[model samples]
Target chain A: MPHPPVHSPTILCTVDVVLLTLTADGLQVALLVRDRAPHAGALALPGGFVRPTEDSGTRDAAARMLREKTGLHSPYLEQLATFSGPDRDPRGWSVSVVYYALVPPMAPDDGAPAAVEWHPVDRLPPLPFDHAEIVRQALARVRSKSQYSSLPVHLCGERFTLPQLKLVYEAVLGERVNQVSFRRRMDELGMLEPMVGETVGGAHRPAQVWRVKEAFRGELSLSERVLAGRD
Target chain B: MPHPPVHSPTILCTVDVVLLTLTADGLQVALLVRDRAPHAGALALPGGFVRPTEDSGTRDAAARMLREKTGLHSPYLEQLATFSGPDRDPRGWSVSVVYYALVPPMAPDDGAPAAVEWHPVDRLPPLPFDHAEIVRQALARVRSKSQYSSLPVHLCGERFTLPQLKLVYEAVLGERVNQVSFRRRMDELGMLEPMVGETVGGAHRPAQVWRVKEAFRGELSLSERVLAGRD
Candidate 1:
């Protein structure tokens, strides 16, 4: 066995959030310009060091970072994976516990004050410190979960017609969905409740508006059958 | 924001492995009696603090601990979740990057001399730290993955008959599986290859034995259709 160093280096701990939202163009990630050293002025994911004195745990730190950096509270937040190594960070050996957050499309007048830049995921510019890989993994996870879950609904606002929700699913899935099957699958999920006296005018007819059930706002409804890509 | 501590305590980093194997009784977890404080003499999962000098990353640390303590090399190991907090450990703030390893049942003389005790997961004794919660999460993850993937096959020897593999799946799932559907599901997975001239005698007939394809030893084959519990 090797003896420990008289003064071993402490590991640097931090949390990074991959905040994703769907737009007219496609899936986009929220990023901010780094305001500190090591990568100052470079665009990067919203992240910060883990403040043990203030954070109850890593999850709390993740939520706090999301709130502080992006100024947007995600309707869905989940721990994706932890990335660590000696060579990943220049300051020292580091471990980053990453979390992915899903929020509905934000209106221009939303109260968030952060200067967040939304970039298409597939056409992202070069990122620093393994953040590009982190975004890729988060995208893969969201897409995979969308195949058999109510995950994509998190990208839709509270009141949406079935066609509107279907578009959100198609945007995340990157494929067309059969209208009939999509309706049937949504019925099976039972995660949405039709809002009484709320209807949206469609090209052919008025469509009933729906909102995710209060019980499932923070949770997901899963299905055994996967949504197949376009035939 | 609060001011930083004059000398803030560093987070104690570690890795804990939940080593699981199926037995005649059902799923069992491997545990070791801690030989040092703060929980000396208490049984807990095989774990240790991360050694940045020798370990490339947290995953490397987990593999090292499993090798040094258990003496059994697992073919299937995956990151389960990270457990972290200030109050979870007695010394100070800590973060445990947890990994779960799946290995086939061992023989009496498997060359492992760690005095390892296998306890049924459902009937585990009191454990130290947040280990009880860690074990629960590991079990839940394994069971969830087993429902739609060839994950339970990790609990079988290299060469096993179909009936034998089915038994392993049943033990992990805690329910009886339909014979016809099980065979069909295995065919869909296509992860097995029949060994030439390898036959095991059974009560009714000679059963042909099969081994997992080399390509799938480190990965799993998944299906969209879930394995339903006992009807």
Candidate 2:
């Protein structure tokens, strides 16, 4: 990192990522036990100090940290908020730009950082520092946007049946969505593309499978209806 | 600002506010001509460095700076986005926590800091550094959120008739809105309260005046219909 003049002004800048995924049980977040000071050995969101010499943006730093700590490459990552204050860190003035990332279900990686684990977001153990509050904010953001966006699709497998996709959305929204209405909204969003030769099997029949359009995978799809709010 | 140990990490931290207000011409932003290095004698958004000792949250710092520099105490302020990169600051690594604030229509303050002025947002002259880019992002955020949120109400007077409020929304949205539907949407939002004793007389019969309910002033009231998009 480049150093400023002898008399300089600087603050600690780091990027913290909330890596969220849908487990068989429910929504979960990746966390790791800190091995360094401030709150050593406490479970916290995976994060690292942003390298000024290398990172051009906080998002790049967040992606790098998630890859290093969790060994998973996420499809959807959006900035949640920036947590900054004099008291947030025991060290001097510090700012942690927080991000929320999403990925499909997968087995734990062999290359994952030691001490890292996935914990149900609702049943998370007490986390270190302000991490617990960070998780709460991330959950609120994801749930709120899920009402009008295709964010929950990131939690589905690469190719998924409509029933499977609807279930993912319901899990994030915590509500029963009508099938016809959900399909209508999906068509309006124009974010899904059918895999012509693909099908997912079930006992009664084989359902046609689809994947999110490449353009919509990393962006939000605004809806005309207020799915969960007063409309 | 406190400095860390000789080899400790540090970055330049600042709080830049996009202070927006309603004007007869259109929405305007508060900007001040720069008087210091890097981009001296150029128009820039009203902002200041974050003081570690006196500031705990970035929002507090933004409010303080807006108060100190623009002579305005904004009622509605929200964190917009963080602009950070190595090249953002010519002097060193910098992170600017940006915020967007709204104020009721009023005459420009005489107490505004020297060199400060209000520029019509749509006809803004070229700004220094990346302030223009910041303004662009701020405008997009404001217009997009206005589609469903009760944000443009800040551009209205303390006591305004339904017609007056509708005009404010239309101006911000850059489109014509149907009166019957606009009123219906406003009622659905439940963010306005009719003033029992107030009326505004115009060419037409006197219309009842309303003010945003206190509870809704600091919160977003969501709606299903898009304010500016095809409806």
Per-model DockQ? 0.34, 0.49
Native contacts retained, all candidates in order: 0.42, 0.48
Measured by TM-score, the strongest candidate is 1
* Count of residue pairs whose backbone atoms collide, per candidate: 0, 1
What TM-score do all the candidates reach, one by one?
0.94, 0.93
Writing each residue's lDDT as its tens digit, candidate 1 over B102-221 gives 998888688666578899999999999999999999998998789889999889988999999988888887788899889988999999999998898976889999999999998999
Q: Candidate 2: which pairs clash?
A: A11-B11
Q: Residue A65 lDDT in model 1?
A: 89
lDDT of 1 by residue, A1-231 (tens): 332322324788888999999999899999999997667899999998888899999988988888887777655999998999988877767899999999988876786555789899999989999999999999999998998899999999888999999999999988889988898889989999999988979668889999999999999998767775532
Q: Write the per-residue lDDT of candidate 2 for residues A26-79, one digit (tens) a residue.
A: 998988988877678888898978888888878888988888778766558888
Point out where model 1 deviates above 4 Å. Answer: A1-9, A202-204, B1-9, B202-204, B229-231
| Model 2, position A105: C-alpha lDDT score | 70
